[model samples]
Target chain A: MHLDKEALDAHESRWRAQLINAVAGFKPVNLIGTIDDQGRTNLAIITSVVHLGANPPLLGMVIRPSPKGVERHTLNNILDTGAFSVNAVTEDMVPQAHQTSARYSGETSEFEATGLTPRWIDGRREPFVAESPLQIGLSLLEHLPLKHNGTHFIIGNIDCIDIPDNAVADDGTVDLGALRLVTACGLDTYHSVGSGTRFAYAKPDQPPRPI
Target chain B: MHLDKEALDAHESRWRAQLINAVAGFKPVNLIGTIDDQGRTNLAIITSVVHLGANPPLLGMVIRPSPKGVERHTLNNILDTGAFSVNAVTEDMVPQAHQTSARYSGETSEFEATGLTPRWIDGRREPFVAESPLQIGLSLLEHLPLKHNGTHFIIGNIDCIDIPDNAVADDGTVDLGALRLVTACGLDTYHSVGSGTRFAYAKPDQPPRPI
Candidate 1:
């Protein structure tokens, strides 16, 4: 149906419902804190993920006001450490990545709850997910706050990545199709990106024939 | 790339380059505005467009900081009337949209800029782009202030969408691919999506297999 006024409202409600349901389908990710001494480890499941830029390897996510009351473990930890890892939640690591969202004693580690091993880098205290297809460690760069939503824009500098060799394509582009890129629709439903069809367009300089 | 620290930096930079190059390839979009009572019109080029949420059918973009401080034509117009239209820029309307971005006399009717017509809605008092692949007129639901970026988020409840019959697929999906969707990479580059190469993935309960 055409998206008229009434239809638009229904589409919006449906879309939001799908997003909430689809978060479960998203491959859970480990937001590893990349910090120095005194930095804390905080992990969370990231369903809304996007590629903002490639040159700087910049990616962005909207961090809503967590129930943790301003002292959000992930956001706070990122600010303290100025570094965090966007660990791809694979079919294998979903459980652990999700456990990271649980409410535990501030000192409790999700890594323990999920039984996932943490890989550390020399000279850097931040840990990376051992099972992720790609692990990107980034440094905090800027914040874009959402006043109405009580969300913050947390921009970061990509410092490192841990991508498996087999997932790379022959061409320069990434072969995410082979990796079964998981997509999040809203809250909990998770869906692996299905067969994606592609189409190309010609130049703007060329005019189209009369319809 | 293994995406070590150095590789991460390179990736970010490269993606930035790709984004800028992508937008430069296409025409611009027309960000249409209207002032009622006197029935004045304003239009501008909005290459800095963003898609906020899919579920709620939310749209967001960076509007120029109003010279009169918070008296923004777009934001105020949207807030006052609770409506606005995001008109996609096309080769035919680039000149008008571009000129609308310039310092035009406050009385100038941008709707009159390109000799193009704005299809006015009776109750909403806003207009839609008859030629847009998607012309959505939305009612304001929320407005957020970005303290750090000096930008505001004017989220509207999408009230209507006027899509071409040929652009929609049978399954209720807007087949922009069929219409040759043009996208901006970064600051300037524009590119058409490549041909569809279907890549499939399995469900959660099933063993991971290629579709």
Candidate 2:
């Protein structure tokens, strides 16, 4: 059956908590970002993260519709400054990282909310969460607009990466199983990455697999 | 250490992508619309799509950084029509769905790109791809400013969804394992839902695991 925009919008706006909460929970490593506000930095864990494109490297996160109807700090900071950090959360820092979501006054910093130390590098002023084994620095690519409701889709151009040395496999693919990344289910529900049985398939043009 | 915006944007603009790519692959199915000057509908599939929000139901897609930049039909369509569809890619029609990505003329419709049909209801001019097990309509959200060299971010408010009955598990979760969804790895690599072992965890206050 066919669905229209008005119908889909109503279903989405109403069942959102149930829909997103369910699907997002299946993925591994909920995304966390660090935004620089004024001079201090703010941190928030985002399960609403997705990989968009690789060439020229891009990543995206949906900031919930704020009640104020303006823009979320993360979106604004990235736009104002043109950069932000997207870090993967670990099973190790799950509790602490989640705390970044606690509601605080605009002036309050999430770093203080969770007491998670920020890692600093000599050449870069932006900080990566010391606890996260994996992280990346994303340059602001675009601030996309959702004309109907004042929502903006922010695209970041990925530049560098930091992976725990041991997690790297021989093929250059970072073995996520070894990293022990965590995935979020519905609200407040978290799960460890499940066992993965890898099976490869060939194109139809290629001969059928030897079963 | 709180990093400055200049430092953050520069680092994040280039790095961090290596990790997200390590895991999240191309698996999503999107309903892309391209209406020609004649107002005929041209729909296509986008496996590389992401959501931008819940409050406003924002959606995003990473289109190939167009060479001409002006030859964009989707961008122009949204600007003119103010809507599009973020259709979910399911296994039932993965083969036909993937075909929508094949290059087509500016005047041709992706609806015809694959054998799949675009379903439409009354009044709303935009149609949904009938085969998309789970499809949603989105109104024009926003077109973000691309910060660096090239590329843009498109955000849209979800207007509707056509979720199939079989896809939803009893618990209201999408049983991807049962659906056997496929994913895209480096470049052209496609993988199916592999091994899965789910574990449940109780609250911290609960007594330690019975030793």
Candidate 3:
């Protein structure tokens, strides 16, 4: 199948969304936890997290514009309080994490609606999902508004991280397969990955070989 | 294991890169192809592709700063030509795709060095990986320099796409499992995904159910 820009623009909105989303292949699925100034907590599943840099420990995510007359709690909360939490979505948490996308009122927390436990840390305003094996706390660093689309590209600095002790390798690589972390395609599909192969550093003179 | 910012800053650079890269879970792995004005081709393995929007078909990627005085061909080509291709990395193509990361001199194309064929479309300046099942052509739309880390955040508009006929579902979701696409973690690890479960649209009143 071949699709040009015209063909893509002609596709039904939902269908185009699914196709475009899947074209990027499997994505990192995580539940972003945030809180408003009134102490109202919000949880939303995000799959657009991209690693920006390692030295500064930066990550970027895109947040769409809020629906007409409806406030996007995650974006607003992050702007209100410069902190948020990222919790890796595991296989067991798929249903609850998917359910968090439902349109819950501002008064109702997704944690309360989906029955997921919110883990709070001392001196931190954001909440993390207790069921997640890997949790990260970040503070907003830069928020750039994309004019082409109304989406906001948000960059954050990693403040701290909590991971399972057994999941870390001697070289500092985290064993994602051991944690059963789930990846997503499109807006609704969830995939569990197999134990992967690690390759040695590539050199110009030789073919890549498994480490 | 819990790591605060201070602890993370104290770790070795390579170890920190591995740990920080893995925290986000499985990432979409793609071979980014570009060509310079003089027609020298460059291919690089990229794992930072993120879906920005569906309607305009926008995607964003991060390019790290070049080492010392070495010219990063991929970044320079995209900026010079305003065109690039994203080819989905599959299980069979992992070794060759990984080999593209080897530092080759400007005269040698990665396609030639790794024994991978480059497919060029008429009138398109970028080349797609022939071994890839899903290939996309994009034109540069915006280039924003991230001041925090000196990385470049590049946004592009999808111009065209080529996909396998049998891989697309009725609802427009592409079956990545059928394509045997692979996701990467920690810079060197590659994982094949299982057939994912698609969930029905969530409603606040009920638990999410598989579609």
Candidate 4:
């Protein structure tokens, strides 16, 4: 099947969103934890997280423009407090993680509503999902507005990272398969890690060998 | 173990890169195809692709600053031609896709070197990977540079999209499981999709029901 620009533009907005979102395939799923100035807690499930750079220890995620007149609490809290946490969603926590996307008022705490525990670490203002096997605390470093769309790319510097001892390899690679981190597709689908193959570093004259 | 900013800053750079890249877990992998003004074809495997928005059908990816003084052909080609194509990397193409990351002279064609075919589509300036099950041609919409890290966020508007017939669902969701698309973790590890679960749209006061 072919979907040209004209046909994609002519399709219903809802269908286009679903198609485009799903077409990207599996993405890292994380629950973003933020706190407002008044100490209000906000948690939202986001699948757009991407590693930006390691020297500065930066990570970036896109926050879409709020629909109609609704204000996104997650974006607002991140800006207000300048602190947030990214928690890897696990298989057992998939239900609670997805529930964080529900249309709740800003005053309503998604963490409490979804029955996910919020824990404070390093005395940071934001909370981290306690059930998550891996969690990282970040401070807002740069917030750039993406003009092409009304989205904002939130870049943060990793301040503190917590993980299980068995999940980290000697070379510093995190064993995501052993961590049992869950990935997401489309809007509502969740997937668990399966068979994985690691290839040795590629070279011009050398064929890739399985590590 | 807890790795705070102090510890992270003291670690070796190579360890930091591997750990940070792997901590994101699985990410969508694609082969980016482009051609320079001189008509030299270029292809590189990238995992930073993210769906920005659907209304304008925008996609964004991060192009890190060239290591040392070496140039990145993919970024140079996109800027020169104002066009590029993203092709999903299949399971069997993992080795070839991974090899595209090797440091090759800009004069050398990665397609020929990696044993991948470049197919022109819709009279576009760029060529799509012929082996990919899903391919998209895009025109450069916006080019934003990150000041903090010197990375470039290339935003492109979808001009055309091609996918296999059986992979698309009635709701427009792409069944990655059926497509057999492979995802990447860390820098060299590849993983195929596993068991996936779908849930109904979440609601404010209602518990999420599995679909």
Q: Best candidate, lDDT-wise?
A: 3
Off by over 4 Å in 4: none
Docking class of 2: incorrect
Q: How far is each candidate from the true structure, as Cα RMSD in Å? A: 9.1, 6.9, 1.1, 1.2
User: What's the lDDT for residue B123 in model 2?
Assistant: 48
Off by over 4 Å in 1: A1-40, A67-71, A205-211, B8-211
CA lDDT of B195 in candidate 3?
81
Best by DockQ: 3
Q: Write the residue-wise lDDT of candidate 1 on A92-181 in tens digits.
A: 554455455456445655555566667776655577776666667677777677554466667666666666667543323344445544
Q: Candidate 4 lDDT, tens digit per residue, A1-211?
A: 8889888988888888888887766799999999888888989989999989988889999998566635478888898889999999988999999998888887799988999999998578899999999999999998988876789999998998988989878888777878788888787889887768988887888886888
Count clashes in each candidate, considering only residues at least 3 apart in sequence or on different chains.
54, 41, 0, 0
* Cα displacement (Å) at residue A69, model 2: 9.7
Predicted candidate 1 versus true structure: per-residue lDDT over B61-173, tens digit per residue: 44546435633666666667777876654444434444454445556656665555777766767876655555667777777664433556555655666667775444343
Tens digits of per-residue lDDT, candidate 3, B1-211, equal: 8899888988999889999989987899999999999988999999999999888898899888565535478989999999999999999999999998888889999999999999999889999998999999999999998999888999999999999989998889888999999999888999989989999999888879998
Model 2: lDDT to the true structure: 0.55
Per-candidate DockQ values are 0.12, 0.17, 0.86, 0.79
Report lDDT (Cα) of residue B25, candidate 1: 16
Question: Each prediction's TM-score against the native?
Answer: 0.55, 0.65, 0.98, 0.98
DockQ preference between candidates 1 and 4, better one:
4
Give per-residue CA lDDT, model 3, range A48-85, as digits (tens): 88888888898899988555735489999999999999
lDDT of 4 at A93: 91
